[model samples]
Target chain A: MKRTLRKARLLLGVTYAEMMEYRAELYLWALSGIMPFILMGLWAKAAGETPMGMPPVDFVRYFLAVFVVRQMTMVWVVWDFEYDVVNGQLSPRLLHPLNPVWRYVASHVGERFSRIPFVTALMGIFFLLYPKAWWVPAPGTLALAILAMLVAFIMRFVMQYAFAMLAFWTERANAIEDLWFTLYLFLSGYIAPLEMFPPAVREATLYTPFPYLVYVPAKLLAGQPVPALTTGFLVTLAWGLVFLALQQVLWRTGLRRYSAMGA
Target chain B: MHGEHYVPEPMPSLNGSRYAVAWRRFWLSSLAAEAEYRLNFILATTNSLLALAGSIFGLHLFFRTGYRLGGWSWEEALLVMGVFTLLDGFASALLNPNLNRIVSHIRDGTMDFILLKPMDSQFWVSARHFSLWGVPNVLFGLITLGYAGKKLGFGWTEWAQGSLPVALAVLILYSLWFALAATSVWFVKIYNVTFVLRSFLEAGRFPISAFPQPSRFFFTFILPVAFLTTVPAESMLGRTGAGNVAWAGVTAILLLLLSRWFWRFSLRFYTSASS
Candidate 1:
């Protein structure tokens, strides 16, 4: 375990340097997370005085927290994995001792590390522009929020990796990803806070994995009373394990088929 | 082979019948190629419908709380979304496929084939591919617009006034896309700039009044998304005057000219990777 950890650390350092080479693209990718900020404007205006149980200040704080979390959590691994599988790029990694998933994990985490400084700078600008919109949560809530976000990140990665494995069977993995994205857009506090969703829709989504990926973490960070945070954490962990199992099955079957085809 | 390729054919000009025939052949071939993947076509149509449904749901959520989206009624918001969908469909069908093509052509040095041709390089690169798949999105947008128009009780007179501004907005949009894609001649690695442009355009999914006052000015003049989507919807609703339509027409002409100048200037700097 210690050896694996050391190898992972070295791999992460290399990926971080490579990502720094394309710093401009990375910044532009981060700028794409501005959907939350754009929606914040309309929502704040609509919530003129405490509509949907959230005041305008709370709405601002929630969305700003959401902006920070989304930048950290988003992974483009599905596209990368699909392209590699189709192009036979996975053959080289299969020859190595380390699992290819670990390399992907390293690169993703490395990117997250590289983006922290930029996100912090953007946060500084945000606070400078809207002084009253900023909120500093209490220590306990902040700790919980961090834990939830870490779990959320892992859950999302595993789920997306499983989705990408479908490329082994068909060429339309991206179309499937697009469908998933449409669902995530509505259910994950993207269009609006989950609280703003109609009662039936909110209740239905709580049973799914979508809210835990974004809304739960953002709400906890904003110091809102997440009455189901305990349940949410457990459910998120369970979904991660489920997706991890699915990925293992699909990878094994796919490797068998790929080798049979001499690819 | 080289001599034959270099010989100029006896054609009238770039806009001759031969070129039109070639264009028709390309579209027909593209249609046949895309037809082979039936499931994929269905999936594409379903995906666009899902997106349309998502936007409608967003409008529902906003109005269910009994709060106006910046003083616009539910139908007005739907109209704005309809206009956005219409223009966005046209962009996906026509503009987006060429964006990735031009970026890759420059990066991989495949642009030499295009530059060597006798036709205008800009025109050839931009019109080589069309996504017939985006037809469903255009149809859905029209359906939404029709539904909203019925609710608002729009008359033919209103439609006539709306057509002028909408036409000008289309001109400005095409020029804006041209300028963005032309920038790739210098900034070769910015393949995903279209996604950035898409984000900018997404703001047009709602009315300009939904934004704050300062952002209203920014969207109207600086980025011009308000002019692209919202102005036409307001024109249809009879809320805009003739003067606003005239201003939009002027902006369209100026932007079109600027884009032409920028494209020519950028072409001079493009050093083909193959040579």
Candidate 2:
């Protein structure tokens, strides 16, 4: 266990150093995630005129929480994995004592670390612009929201990694991820809050893994009432397990295919 | 010998017809190369359709609550959405496939080859690739525009007048993308800058007036996103004054010139990959 911990420390340290070298690119990526803010403007406007069960300020806070949670939970494993697999770069990595997945995990964590200052700065500017929408959550709520964000990140990573395993069979595996992302963008509460969804649509989407990704953590952070907090966590866990199992199976099968290709 | 001077002969400029031929050859070769990926075509079409459906559904959510987006009726907002999709299609088809390669060319020193050519470097880079993936979005966007136009009782004259702004919107979008892509010379790792621009341009999916005062101002004067889809939709609906159209034309021409100037300026900083 000590040895494993030391290895993880080295990996994360190295990746974090690599990430810091591209600070400007990282800032641009953080700025690219301003979609939630744009939607916040639109939703806040709509909610002002119509009774959408939430006030304009609530919409503001909700989307602010969303932007934060999304930044924490973003995943792009499919693109990287596809590149490595297609270019035969995975051959060298397969010789490592460690599972290759750990590298991706460490890199993502390092990027998250690198992003903290920029994300905080953006949030500062946002609150300065709309100070009325600012409020601190209770300590307990903040703790739970942080936990939820971590789990949501894990679930998203596992799902995209599973999709990445398709690189074994296809060159354009990222295209599949693009399709999945389209669904995620709409149904994952990224575009609008679930409260604004039609009643039937909201009920239906709850059964999918989409809402638990963004809505649950965001609502918890925004201090909005999430009626079934335990249920949300359970569903997130369930989806994570499903994707984890799928990824393991694909990893074994894909490795066999990789070796068969004379790699 | 010290006092002797040599004068170089003037090279012939390639005119419009030569450029037309070159454009055709560039697209045909790219199309042939891309046609090998038949499955990709299907997947791309499906993805575009799904995205369009989701956008319409999202717009419908606001209308279902009896809130007209920026005081636009449902059909009018649909027009805006239609124009946004069309521009997105144009980007994906030409601008993305071509301009996204600028960073790689700069990184690999392949840009030296492009510059050595007799043709205009900007024209060559911007017209190089034509992907088939975006054709579906183009078709779907036109269908939506037609359907919405019919619902709004738009006549042929309105469509004709609207085409001018739509064309100008294309020019404005191309300039913005080219200028952003040219920044790769200074910041080779900043490939995602265009993505940042794209996210900001997402505001064009809605009518500009739908946003709050500050947001409207930002989209209008700062980014000029208001000229992209909203102005064209307004032209089609006959809600915009001739002055708005004139402003859009001016903005398009000025931005085009600015992008041309920016490209030349950026080239000064482009030390090829090795040098």
Candidate 3:
């Protein structure tokens, strides 16, 4: 266990240094997530003109929370993995003592660390622009929200990594992810809050994994009520486990096909 | 000793006809190159359709609450969405595939060869390649416009009126994208800077007036996103005054000129790779 911990530490430290070298690019990536803020403006304006069950300020806060959650939970494993698989770069990594997936995880963790200052700076600018939306959550609620955010990040990472497994068979695996992202964009509360969704649509969307990715944690972070917190956590874990099992199966079978390519 | 008296020949002038021929060759070659990816075309079409459906569904949520966004009716807002999709298609087809390569050119020193060419560097870089993937979005946008226009009782005259602003919107968008992409001359590693502009342009999916006062100001003056889709939609609906269309024309011209000037200024800072 101690040796494994040491290895992880070394991997993360090296990757973190690599990520820090591209500080300006990382900041631009952070800035590219301003879609939530733009939507916040539209939602807030609409909510003011009508009774949308939440006030305009709540919409602002909700989307700010969404921006934070999105930044923390973003995953692009499919793009990287597809490039590696297609370029035969994975051949070298296969000989490593640890699973190659750990390398991706280490890099993602490193990027998240490098991105913290930029995200904080963006949040500061947001509050400076609209200070009326600022509020602190209770300590208990903050703790629960942090835990939910972490789970949401892990769940998203594992799910995309499973999708990345398809690169073993096809060169266009990222296209599939792009199609899935279209659905995620709409159903994941990236465009609007769940409360604004029609009753029937909201009920139906809750059954999908999309809402748990953004809505659950974002609501908690905004200090809004999440109808069934425990159930949300359970569903998230269930989906994560399903993907984890699928990834393992795909990895074993894919390695055979991968070697047939003379890698 | 003879090399000292060598007079450099005057280069051929780049007239309009020459530019037309060059653009045709550029697009034809790119299309031939892209024709190999049959599966990508199908996938791109499906992605565009799904994205359009989702956008309509999201817009429907607001109108279902008996609340109009920025006082725009459902059909009126659909016009805005249609315009936004059309511009997005144009970007994918031309601006994205071409301007996105500016960073790589600067990085790998291929830009040196580009500069050594006889033709205009800006024109060559901006019009070198086109992708076929965005054709579906263009068709879908036109279909949506027709459906919405029919519902709103729009005639050909209305369409003609709207075409001017729509064309200007394209010019404005191309200028914004090219200016952002040219920043690679200084910040070579910031390939995703155009993505920041793209996220800001997402606001064009809705009417500019739909945002709050401060946001509306920012979109209007800072980004000029108001001229992109909202003005065109309003012109189509006959809700905009002549003044607004005139202002949009002025903005488009000014922005286009500004982008050209900015490109020239940034080239002074372009120290070629390995120099």
Candidate 4:
């Protein structure tokens, strides 16, 4: 574990330097999550007279919280993983003493950390433009949201990694990711808060991993009513375990198939 | 690369007289190349259809919560989305595929070779690599637009009146995209700006008035996404004013000239990799 942590530190440093080298690209990528801001405007306008049990101001705050929560939980490791698998880049990593997953985890975490300052600057500018949307959550709720966001990040990462492993079997793995992204955009508190969803759809979405990734965390941050913090944590943990197990099975089978194919 | 097959023929003059024929040959070559990847074509078509479904479902859910979004009825919003999909299809089919080539050329300094060619470099880089697979997206967009127009009782008169502004809107979009791509000359790492542009383009999926007060103008003038999708939809619905069409035309001309000037200016600073 100590060695793993040490390697993670080194990987994080290298990734930070590499990310800085393409600072313009990194900045644009960070800003690409602006969909929430756009949706916020649409919803806020629709809720001009309180359309879905929430007023326009409430929509503003909810989407602002959702934007920050999303930035914190965003993951794109599947694309990288797909590239590595297809290009035979994973073979060298497999020989490393440390697990290759840790390298990805470190890189993603590093990128997230690098984005903090940019988002902070953006939030500052955003608050200037719409100060009414800025409100402090309760201290306890803030802590809970942070924990939920960490869990959400892990769940998303593992789920994406499992999906990326499908690249070992199919060339159209990114297409599958694109499909998942479409679903997530609607179901994952992106288009609107989950509370705004019809009760039947809301109940069904709670059973899926999409809400845990964005909705639950944003809900926690907004200090809205939730399905109990413990319940969310447990559900997220269960999903993470399922995805990890899936990854293990796929990784083993994929590796064998990969070797057979002479990669 | 398949580009080797495109050998320049002997010409009488070097005043870019061969541009039309060259573009046609390149388009045919691209179509032939993409024909080899049958599965990729199928997947691309599936992705486009899936995207159309997602947009429809999202609009369904949005309208379910309220009768209208930002004063536009559900059908009007659908029309905006249809226009957006049509323009986005044009981007993928014509503009975006060449964007990747431009970035690589800038990065590896192969842009100099293209510049040395007798043909216009900007035209060459911008018009090359026609994505035949994305043609279905255009068809899909037209079908969606037709469906929405049918629901709204729109007829040929509305379309005929809207055609000029729509054509100008397309020109404005292409010029804006060219200016964005030309930034790679000075900023070699602007490849991901395409993603940013796509995000900005997504704002066109709805009426510009649907955005916040401050951003309505931002999308209208600064980025001009309003002209790209919203104005076209309004023209189709007969909601557009004569002044709006005039403004759209002026913006298209100014942006086209500005991009041309910028492309020429940036070429002076481009130091070739071979040098």
lDDT of each: 0.83, 0.91, 0.90, 0.82
- Per residue, candidate 2 scores C-alpha lDDT tens digits across A1-263 of 99999999999999999999999998889899988988999999988887888899999999999999999998998999999998888888999999999999999999999999999999999889889998999999999999989988988899999999999999988998899889999998888889888999999888778998899899989998887777777777788889889999999999888842337
TM-score on alpha carbons, each prediction: 0.94, 0.96, 0.95, 0.93
Alpha carbon lDDT at A61, candidate 1? 84
Clashing pairs in 2: none
Which lDDT value does model 1 have at B131? 84
lDDT, residue A155, candidate 4:
84
**What digit string (tens of lDDT, one per residue) describes model 2 on residues B27-70?**
99999999899998999999999999999999998888888888
True contact recovery of candidate 1: 0.45
lDDT of 1 by residue, B1-275 (tens): 68856966576555777678667766777788777878877888888898899889887887888888877899988888988888888888878877557778888888889899877777777777788667888888889988998899988987787788778877888888888888888878765566776787788898999887777788889988888878899999999888888889999999999988998898898888755
- lDDT (Cα, tens digit) per residue for candidate 3, span B144-261: 8898999999999999989999999999999999999999898887764788898889999999989999989999999999999999999998889999999999999998999999
Q: Which pairs clash inside model 4?
A: none
Q: Would you give me the overall lDDT of model 4? A: 0.82
> What TM-scores does chain A show, candidate by candidate in order?
0.95, 0.97, 0.97, 0.93
Ranking by DockQ: 2, 3, 1, 4
Could you give the DockQ of candidate 2? 0.78
After the best TM-score superposition of candidate 4, give how far the Cα of residue B63 lies from its true spot, in angstroms: 2.6
**All candidates: CA RMSD (Å):** 2.6, 5.0, 4.2, 2.8
Q: Cα deviation in Å at residue B237, candidate 1? A: 0.7
